[model samples]
Every structure is written in C-alpha cells, then in structure tokens.
Target: MTMMSLSWSLVSIANKKQQQIRRFKITIHRLFGFAFLCSISFFLFSPKIPRSPNYHQFADMRNLLGVPNTLNVITNFPFLVVGVLGLILALEGGFFTISSQAEISTWILFYAGILGVAFGSVYYHMKPDNNRVLWDTLPMMVAYSSLFSSLVVERIGQRIGLGCMCALLFAAFTCIVYERIYDDIRLCLMFQLILPLAIAAVAYMYPSNYTHSTYWFSSIGIYLLAKLEAVSDKKLYRANNYVISGHSLEHVCLALIPFLLSVMLICRERKFKRLGDLKDQL
Candidate 1:
C-alpha cells in the first residue's frame, strides 16, 4: 500500500480502539449506576429491622479507673485526636496542593464526624441504651457519607460529588429519623452496607487521580477488619482473656482509616490537573 493509505489505515484502527474503550467505560458506569439504583430500591422495599434486645450487651464489662467498658470507651479517643488533627491540617492547607476549598470542607466534615463519634460512642457505652446508640451511630453515618463524598470528588466531578454528598447526608439523617419514629433500623443498616459497596465500586471503576490510591484500599481493608472485630466481639474478648474486646479493637482499627486517608491526602500528588484528563485518558 502507498504511505498515505497506510497512515490512514493506522489512524482508522486507532479510532476503532478508542471507541471500544469508551464503550467499555460507559458499560461499567452503567453497571455501577444500576447497582446503586437496586440498593436504593431494596432499602425502600425491605421490611424494617427491629433492634435486638441484646444489642446493648458487650463482652467487656470490666470497670477500670471508675469507667465501665473502659477499653472500648477509651480506645475511641484516637478518633477524636485524628479527627481534630485532620481538621487542623486541612485548615492549615497541609494536604496536597490543588485541593479546592470544597474538598477541604469535606475533609473537615469527615474529621468532625470522627470527633463526634469519639464523644457519642463514649456516652453510648456508658449507658448502652438505644437513645445513646443514636448518638454513637449518627456521627458514624456522617463520617461514612463524607468519606463517600470525598472519594466521589476525587474520582468524579466536583459538582457531582458535592451533590452526592448532600444526598448521602440526607439519607443518613433520614435513617436516624426513621429509626427514632418507627424503632426500626433497616434504612440505617442498608445505608451502612450500601455506602462501602459504592465506595469500592467507584474506586474500582474510576481511575485514580492521586498517587496514593492504594491508601484507599488499605483504609477499606482496615474497615473490613473493624467490622469483623465488631461481629466477633465476644469471641475476641474471651480469646484475649477478657483484657480487651474485639469491639474495642474495632474502634482502634476504625480510627486508623481517617488517619490513613489524611496521610494519603498529605503525601499524594495529583496525576491529572482536571477531571477531563481522567475521562480523555485513563
């Protein structure tokens, strides 16, 4: 073939390949969107989950230094420390350069929520009642929703991310309200389950803009460990000779998540200058 014809053939092949990649990315986006919708539908249709009568009981009841559930309650102090430190860092512009004001605000909220968890959880463990449980779980929902928003902002558009953040916060509060009025926790539980899945899916489907995306995965791993610890609370307490419970360690693991995320923000540099770069390239 002539040089001109060969060049044209090569260009055509490249164009086809580009189109295929676009189609694949679009397909993945649609799949994630479908999964999100299904999660919402399930939350709307599922029966209300009643609070267990035994939910207030914890394996570690040892009073230490005049505090009940001392380890579980005190281990949460790291959350407050991390949260306040994160907020200060954000306020002082300690994160990677190019983070916008809105992004900083989201970080602040996430940290503040962590701080609230510290106080609220301490109060809940003091009494172990449903009313106090609201205080504990409400702040957690805030932290979870803000983290979701932060990830969305990093991987998607800022406007879209902010909108999703607002929606998620509203959903989170609604769960609390629904539980208070109806004494059911289905929506709250669903929110907890769905948000992590959404975060994971977004991380998987979208290209990372920062160098330390692996930190997100690490945070998720830590979160899963916390959940496992929480579920195996009694077993872990017994195994440890009643010195500390899995629930307490769960708090410690959870506290690490925000700290790791802050480290990511502080240490990682951007791979892209704009959202368009993510779409047009990776």
Candidate 2:
C-alpha cells in the first residue's frame, strides 16, 4: 500500500480505539452515577427511627435539603466516595472528548458533594456556641478553584478551552442573578461570579484569531440557560422546607447536557472539515 493510504488506515484504527475508550468510560460513568443515586435513594427510603441528633439524627427526611446534625458527616461517606469516582471519570472525559468536558460535570458533582460535607460540618458537627467545624468545608473552595483552573489554565492554549471558560463564567453570573432574585442569596455568589470572570477575561484579552468563536458564544448562551435553572432552586421550595416544586432536576439536566456534549466533542469520530464542524467547537 502507498504511504498515504497506510497513514489513512492507521488513522482509522486509532479512531476506532479512541471510540472504544470513550464508550467504556461513558459506561463506567453512567454506572457509577446510577450507584450514587441508588445509595441516596436507599437512605431516603429507609425507615426513620427517631433518636438523639448525634449518630443518625440528621439521617431523617428533614435533613435532606441541608445538614441537620453530625450524622451527616458519617452518612456522607457513600456520596463522597461515589463523587470521587465520578470526578475521576469526568477528568477522563475532559481528556478524551471535547464534547464531554468532564471538568464541567465534575464541578457540578464536586460542588454538590462539598456542599453536603460543608453543610453537615457547619450545622451538624459544630457547636452552636463555639464554631470550629467551619474550616472543614474548605473543600468547596478547592473544588471551585480546580474547576476554573481546568477550563481557564489547563485549556488556555486551545480555542475550545477558552470558549468553555467563557460560557462557564456567564453561567456563574446567571446563577448569581437568579439567586439574588429568588432571595436565596449567599456571600459565596459574589466570589463565584467575579473571580472566575476576571480570570477568563484576562485570559481572553490576548489577541488571537481562532476558528471557533462559535464555541464561546454558544457556551455563553447555554450557560445562561443553565444558570437560570440553578439559581431557580432558590424558588423551588416553600416555607415549610418541603420540596413542593422546582426541584434540582432542571439544574442537573442543564449542567449534564453541556458536560456530555463537551465529552462528545472530544472523543467522537467525525470529519474535521473545520473547527466549527464539532458542536463543542471549543
């Protein structure tokens, strides 16, 4: 065979290998995610035995929305472990597929996990008069920092990375607005929005002509929609603390959609006519 044809054949084989890898990773991710959900479901469905709010006090239904007692510190182990696995899978997705952008998914999951841990440490384990457990929640900040680093620093040289970071910043802002409107605002909102946007803008200011402006624009749009959903969680429940409506499913779906798409962008087989040919275009 001619060298050109031989090269094409090798490329074909490599493409197939990458696809198999992507499929395997995606399957693992899904299965682990299912297990995580199932664990939560099992805990939720278990009979509620009333007792002191120390060992399993926070295990009851009232604590599902947030931490109620120190038991959460113990109960959170299953979720924390599952979340760690999910984070690994997501990091692989980021490496393997632009369409998947596992960092995005990882951030969402990481956020949830850290939040659970933090809420539990702050509300359950800590003393009402003496505050010491507050420091235990620092993982939340670390997780956020890592997320921005992946999008802004790790993906900096590449066009797609820039686009993804831009979109994420926009989404973060949208979340801030939504939370503010819903009256569920937290001091963390300002830090989440401003710090990331500042970093992304500085990163983008360096002049360069790229083929994939669409990725940035599209990401921004998607992020706006997603943030709207995330912030809407503020309005999801009622005064009684019961989840009567507007639960977190929308936010999860929105976040997951971009994440999965970003993964596909990286790992899927397709024509490379132009950068824009890929939906992740980032």
TM-score of each prediction: 0.83, 0.34
Summing lDDT over every window of 10 consecutive residues in candidate 2, give the lowest-scoring window.
51-60
Error of 1 at 194 (Å): 0.4
What lDDT would candidate 2 get against the real structure? Answer: 0.42
TM for candidate 1 is 0.83
Q: Between which residue pairs do clashes occur in model 1?
A: none
Per-residue lDDT, model 1, residue 226, is 95
Off by over 4 Å in 2: 1-82, 90-137, 155-189, 199-234, 238-282
**Tens-place lDDT digits, model 1, residues 172-206:** 99989999999998778878887887788677766
RMSD per candidate (Å) reads: 6.1, 17.0
Error of 2 at 174 (Å): 25
